[model samples]
Target: MKISYHSPHEPNCSICKKQCRFYDSLREHLIGPLPKAECAKQFSERGCSLCLKVFPTAQQLNNHRAACQSLPPLPAISGLRPSLVNKRNQAEKEQILEESSNKSNISGIAMDCEMVGGGRDGSLDLCARVCLVDEEEKVIFHCYVRPPIPITDYRYDVSGIKPEHLMGGMPLKQVQEKIQQILYNGEAIWRIRLKGGKAKVLVGHDLDHDLQCLGLEYPTHLIRDTAKYIPLLKSNKTSNSLNYLTQSFLGYKIQNGTHDPYEDCVAAMRIYKKMRNEDHSLSATEFVPENGVYSRMRQKELEKMSPEALLQISQSDFYCWCMDSR
Candidate 1:
């Protein structure tokens, strides 16, 4: 998706180029405040949309793209998972087992869940389907889950899950066990002593909700949530929707039709990988804080640190699972 840049009146950061409200200035032109050091680093190395080449100057990018060959479009992805549970069998189970078995040393896997309402008012979320994908975008596990409570709302329009779909769905406990097995690489969670362990990172958007609905818990350090990633947030410092982040950052559209957990999983993984590829480049002397208290520090304390040091100690406005991972 292309960003609209028709308005020159709108203020934008000189370094990061993100449009935002401007502060009063006598010069009538200040390109807004200087962006955080990390943001400056990112904008300086931005890739050209037309040619996929990184250029230091917008003029250079434009000139290069004018004569550059366009890259081929990626093929459409499909067969992510079945809409019905009857289609699942031993073959599918074996495929998941094989994939999980191979991930003992892998860095992380992405996950997404579809939920149905089950409370009296059909207001409580319950996990109905789950999808997990590896770094290569291969499906590690995907299955429909039976909610423990009777589903008051199948949320057919949103989730595409009907009553028939859950008839043969895996029990909630079984689904939870399978997901835990895949995430933990079959090692018991309690036995994993270190932050760096057999446990693989879990990538997703709004993962707390997904894990809550699924009734599963994972180490904070092992979760990468796109919605809470600091640099990916909107100008207002609010979390962006997964669909917006996918189209705006990853150059694709998803979740337009009835929600597909696998598609969402892939999108979340792509965003996380994109962020992971950045050169944050903090020095060993610049320590990252644990309890996320940097933002609450007094202005005097903040002013004492250099911009790079500030960036090092800064935390996401929201609870980013990636924080613990760092």
Candidate 2:
């Protein structure tokens, strides 16, 4: 492949794809062929060489590498990091957010959860704090959670949770119910499932982990995860953190100290709103799936189907919650 040098007019960023004024080496990790400038600098810092993406921390990049499908495996990567890896395992909950559902009442709600360590080694995630915000960025609910397991590590450096803070804290069950009330707007989950009751879309970063830790479940289609958003993904197709995303997209810093759940919620919601407002168009021909119900069918079977029939089996390359806004 003919490798090109970096163009002054269009310096590519591996993660956000925003035009950079200077050269960035991370573009090498993209699926496309070699570009103008190959990143010649030897980065001593922990970065995914495959994608030329540099993260704020080694642990963050390590978390990204596991989910990067394009990169080949490396040796002795840290497994001690939390399961930010499988955050992309899209649940079939999309069926519930069917285009026919009502979009009134609450459009969406942003949520953030602070975790403390639990279990024998203090490795398991326990939701120690939770915060919910409305579309107007008002805090609807904020509370400390008394984890089911004894706290082994408050992770004070990040979570800011203290032993005293969780004292007489709300139970996990209560937290779940309260969050559900805000999400479901007093409607039962079953009604939302059966009669097409539109629950507010839950917005957050790496929300799967938070939902799992809280023992909560919501329709997959109603989830607006910044971590899995296509435009927010790294060039290597791995997830970016709420911090990096906030700073890059929103022009601010967060999680710089003991993380604030409200701050995180605002960041997630802001990004979601920005994405939702973006002007874009989708064409079926441009977003063909390589392997799915439509692509796997035999030529004869496909030939027998009508245009409307073909449309029924089609799917997009990525999920965009903004489509629902239309």
Per-residue alpha-carbon lDDT of candidate 2 for residues 1-326, written as tens digits (9 for 90 to 100): 11112221223444444343222223432323554333323223554543345576888877976653221112111121222211212242223222213335558788889899988898999998788777766656667788887898889888877786776577899878877877886678899999998688899999999999999989998899988776577766688888877765565577666777777888898778866764434434533444433343455565786754454344434555557568
How do the residues 117-230 of candidate 1 rate in per-residue lDDT, one tens digit apiece? 988899999898888888787777777888888989988878988787777788989888888888777777777755545778788999999998888888886778877765
Best by lDDT: 1
Q: What lDDT, from 0 to 1, does candidate 2 have?
A: 0.64
Alpha-carbon TM-score of each model against the true structure: 0.69, 0.62
Candidate 2 clash figure, as a count: 6
Model 1: clashing residue pairs? Answer: none
- Give me candidate 2's TM-score against the actual structure: 0.62
Cα distance off (Å), candidate 2, residue 192: 0.9
Q: Cα RMSD for candidate 2?
A: 14.5
